[model samples]
Target chain A: MATETAAATGGQASPIALEEAGICVDSHGGAIGLPQLCPDWMGNQIFWLAVTLVIIFFVLSRIALPRIAAVLAERQGTITNDIAAAEDLKVKASEAEAAYDKALADARSDAQAIVAQTKADIKADLDAAMAKADAEIAAKTAEGEKAIAEIRAGALDAVKEVAKDTAREIVAAMGGQADAKTVNAAVTSQMKG
Target chain B: MATDVNGAAEQSGGLVFHPMDQFIIKPLFGDGGVGIFTVTNITLWMAITVLATIALLVLGSSSRSTIPTRMQSIAELAYGFIRKMVEDVAGRDALPYFPYIMTIFMFVVMANFVGLLPGAFTSTSHIGVTAVLALLVFFSVTIIGFVKHGAGFLSLFWISAAPLPLRPILALIEVISYFVRPVSHSIRLAGNMMAGHAVMKVFAAFAPMIIISTGIGLVVTPLSILAIAAIYALEVLVAFIQAYVFTILTCVYLKDALHPAH
Candidate 1:
């Protein structure tokens, strides 16, 4: 009802004023009268579209790219640092290996010297024992020879006593008168022989 | 009866409701709230927008040389302008969204310009059109936020930098803000287009009056012509500005969606 009144008012007033002013205005094909498929829809589309576009702009520009770049840069830095560290470690390892080899060589030489010294000591001890055994055998042989010479001398002395005794007994049986001269001569001859 | 009708009409507010008219074009609907459906009118405009953007972009990009042509320079200027805007608003993280931003700016700028054509339909004039576009953005951004942060996206509305005691109040504000997105998004474009057209109509309605007088008619008619010319130029500037404003807002929204800081 209100719309009808407003429309009637507009219709009456606009035409009357135009006629009074000796002018006829045709508003049929005016910009406002164009048949739109959906004004509300069009308006909404435009509004929401603008919003969406802005959102997309904000997200891509501010958040995602910077983080990605930062992560990439950090990764690159870490990788480079790791490579450098590995190189340094390699050099250090090589130096350590060299030092280890030198120490091993020195230890090996030291061990060889100790072994040679021990072998020499053992050889000397063996030679000394052999020399001592030879000395003992020589001393025993000399003592045995000395004992044999003494025994021969005693046997000879006994033999001589027995011969004299036998000669005396034979003389005494033969003649009393020639006993003393015979005994003396026999004794003298025995001394000269 | 006519007098009574007028009296009653005057008592009530002057509200015109046309039930026979299709308020918002429903290009797509289904029996159940399911499946893909197409919106014909919007789809047509969308295609038009895309083609117009491609035309401009292709033409602009075709002239590639050490010494750039005017068209190329203009394109470059637009690119640089949006790029700077994104950088300033979203920071350095906005590079990947560059394509989308550029596309939005180009599409909107073209749509606005097309409205200025002699007999072209102003697509942004309707609320339904604006609503769809707004809803698209709203849903897209919300989905993006969820995809990126999963369940944590809800925290954006619930949490803020405010103190514990003030958190509830802040949460309420956040919720209001979230709901208001579609309204603001739709209103901005509709408001600009409506205001511009209304003013133009007011000025144009005066054209016949100025031409009716004999001696004054000559002076007034040209003056009206000049006014129209001036208004038209202003409208052009407005068109470009509206497009830029729309695209910028979209960028801002997208930034929040991606980040979603309390």
Candidate 2:
């Protein structure tokens, strides 16, 4: 590489002179042609390349590759394990959700039962209180009617007594007083008619 | 030796581009001819890549946390990406070869990204390197197919599903294609890396056009710089895509080897 620059700065070597040297490059460092085709360099590159390949082969096969393979396999295993764990966690979460739903449903049913019981109890108490109040109202209405009937009978009987006494007093005052029985009979007949 | 001879000469008082010069392998310690085992820029960059791979793969995952940190995530992403590709393209039976396929992917991808750094040498761009990588997959897959299935592996090239009349022709094509896999696989990666780098260098050469001619430079300089930036961004994408293509192609071939059914 430096030879090319040197040739650019310095003078060109005579073709024959550089050719007689039996080398690829002229003394001025410029290549006679494409250096890749140069037989002089092929041997060196091929030889070193063989050594380099062998060294690389050994380094990779014996050490690097196996190490890398282990790391990769380990990573793969770890990923698989993590996914499995996630799946397990997911299953557990669903189970917990199911349990929660079951408990909620159970509580809802229990609340409905309690509400029904309370409603039924209140209805039974109201029905009994209504029945008791209706019975009391009927009893009071029958007693009040019986007491009015008694008062009327007593007043009618008293009116008959007073009519007989007034008849006897009027007869005596007129100087032709009828008997009490007769007056009572006559007033009863008149009241009857 | 490169025969293009595209040398830089300021005496011409014009643009002298040496785009291929960056691919040249030079000794790290001193100026000398590169021997087979010479420690050149290739070695330096390859070492750097290997270190980066290790650091990312080994130390990054040292924690082995169930929860990955950033570096650990990157390492794991790479591992899982290739592992899935191999499994999907090949069969479950191909898992035994996971480490081998993983090594190639890590090497190619790391070298590509590392090369993208300014002044870095791209190891995957060289045919020598890519060819070797491809051939290893080719040869190993071939051997595995033969060892596992014996003569039955030849059926990979023999298409019984085709009508008997055209079977031979189709078989011939299949045989040719099967043989050409390594060539195509290797060249695809190298060519992509090389071509992108060369285009970037070509554009970069014009970046100093203003110094040469203010009149033409005003138009050329900014355009060239923009082109380089755009190509650089594309190269970054290509670097990863090429690596993916190579590794997946390897898996596809491995599938043929393992199954060889059709």
Candidate 3:
């Protein structure tokens, strides 16, 4: 308070400057009191404040605010679109995976079917070859039996002839001739017994 | 004078404390009266604040890229912060007024932070500036309330939840408090800014204590400096908090105007 009143005896340089400075600054360019309370500067301060607020509001509303809002909205839209695309890609990828799995399963079943067909074909061929081989062996065994029978018959006939000839030779040597009929009958009876 | 030499230690050299002088509205150029048209420090600082707002809001978002740059992201963050505030506090219906709220937030924040620069004048510290900001909010909210609800806006002062007999008293209190909103709002910001700056100035005045007396100065100067640093950090926090408080309060007031039920 003393400092404020001391300004009454302040510098006598210019009373106008003193009044314009308001009761805020002292003669020595120091603050006499709170400058905020001075009424002289309030008008210009408010005026400038108004100008500033107006400028800021104008720039923000007209340019900055809209620009920022658009950028944000655009960014949001891009994110949403990107997310949607990712979801679509994910669906497609899953579909492809499903298709791949189905293909693999089909190939496996087809391979199994092929293996079964080949096994059946091989079994049929083996059964047919074994049957043909058994038929050939049976035919060869029948022929061998017939040949052996024929040979035995021929040997029996030869034995009968030998008996008849031996009887004739014995009869000639002993002065007694035997008949062929009698020799044949004796040989037949002996073979039967 | 007794003012300069209050203490005996002041007798050595004149100790003048011009803490309030930083707030004096001086013309940027020559000595002149601060007429409404006169270009003062207020204009300069306010212009700087305006430029900063433009730089952050306009130029920063020029890319409009989905992958935002730092400046763009900062701009977006500020926008989203205030937009969400207006949406949450004032309701979605108040989105049309978002730009206005955004302007207030950016200006106050920029003015505060910019004013923290050394030797800089704090515009928001002055009642002249804060009063206008507060009054703008006050008038706009009131007008919007009346426009939206007509006489129904008065319901805000009438607490429907209160007992019928006590309703009148509560309404009276509400009306008075509602009227005091501008005063409190403006004073809250200005007082915070003024108090912080003044306290810092007082601390700074002690920074030269060593020049006064090496004996007392040795301890006092370092302490004062440390106090200044500590207060500076606090002031930085106060600066942002005050701006947030001002904007959020604006949003709250706007909500009352929009709803006005209780």
Candidate 4:
């Protein structure tokens, strides 16, 4: 505040002094042409300008820029990696589905083959049992025929013997002997006839 | 009415309000003559711009989170904005100078925005700063053009596609425009900033006058305030646009440097 007052007073006291000194105090009590017309300020402004701009350039190029670039690159890399991983999973899922399909097909064919083989085995067993049963039935019928023929022959012989005994009794009642041989001869002749 | 008071003060040799007083460069410490070593308001504001840039670009984004915070997003937005400007206007080959272009963009934009603060100095509003920046662009582009294309860089001035009779005349015009680039570039930014700030100051001067006046104060005060508000909004847009224009022009000049064909 003191310096401001002093500068203001100095401007009032000797405006010519300030103007001759190249201090930019105009008639309006304001500075003009310091940034454009003044030579001394140029050198200082240029010097500081160079210094500040160089520092800013270095800061941006070396530190801030590279960091941002790295972040962008990292994000891109992650996105690509995720896409590749998803593609790999998709391929694996399709492969699993194919394997399941193949296994199901194989199981169906395997079951069909087993059923066919079992059916063949059962048919062979049934045919063999039927042949054995037919042979046993034929043998029993032959044996029954032989037994009936033997009984009929025995009945014929007993009937011939009775007939001969009856003839002999009749002959004894009638007071005539020697009839057994005759009776036997007569029965045998009748049976032959 | 403030102009009348200022005029009366000037005639009376009393206190005169100089709106341009804000643009003065005085030594921060003493009333001594400013030398090359004297730290002036320009230096202070420039240093502030640098610090603010560091805070935004370095410290704000130090984490580099994939999900950015607001400050980090701002840094990234600025980075991408300048990068695209360099690439789109200057082409892919100009990407090597992206950092330089980005520095200038950030510095100008931050200086302009910070200057909008009530009592802050606007360093970029001075020709000393803008001229240096523009000359740097001009010199670097010229050097790159000479180094890359040798004598062929002169072809930028020669319009080969023009009619044979008017070619020399066209070339003269082109050369004059080419040399005028730095002058116009520096003046454009400084002029816009200086003009906008001066206008706001003028409006502010009116505000006090009209508010204190007996009869017209009621009506004129609100009008001045509204004008200030409206121009303030416009200045905000102008600040961003001027920075953008400076950067894009730099890129365009760089493109010429890299490819000097007509």
Better of 3 and 4 by DockQ: 3
Q: What is model 2's interface RMSD?
A: 4.6
Candidate 2 C-alpha lDDT tens digits along B167-209? 8999899989988999999999999999999899899999888
CA-lDDT, candidates in order: 0.61, 0.87, 0.86, 0.81
Candidate 4 scores a C-alpha RMSD against the true structure in Å of 7.4
Q: List the residue pairs that clash in candidate 3.
A: none
Each candidate's fnat, listed in order, reads 0.07, 0.77, 0.69, 0.51
Query: DockQ of each model against the real complex?
Result: 0.03, 0.42, 0.37, 0.23
Ranking by TM-score: 2, 3, 4, 1
Query: CA shift at B50, candidate 3, in angstroms?
Result: 0.5
Q: Pick by DockQ: which candidate is best?
A: 2
**lDDT at residue A44 of model 1 (Cα atoms):** 37
> Considering summed lDDT, which 10 consecutive residues are worst modelled in model 4 chain B?
B1-10
lDDT of 1 by residue, B1-262 (tens): 3233434544563222221122223344431211123343444555566556544445554534434567655655676787788887766776666666665676567767876665454566555556666776688778888988898887887776777898888889888999898889878886677666556555564565543455776676677667878878988998998888887887787777777875
Model 4, A1-193: lDDT tens per residue? 2234335555354544554565564444465433345555666677777877898899999988887777667777888999999999999999999999999999999999999989988988888888888888878877877788788888888888887887777777788894688879987898889
For candidate 1 chain B, the 10 contiguous residues with the lowest summed lDDT are B15-24
Worst 10 residues of 3 chain A by lDDT: A1-10
DockQ leaderboard ranking? 2, 3, 4, 1
Pairs with backbone N, CA or C atoms under 3 Å apart (clashes), candidate 4: none
Distance (Å) between predicted and true CA of B108, model 3?
0.5
Candidate 1 lDDT score at position B203: 54
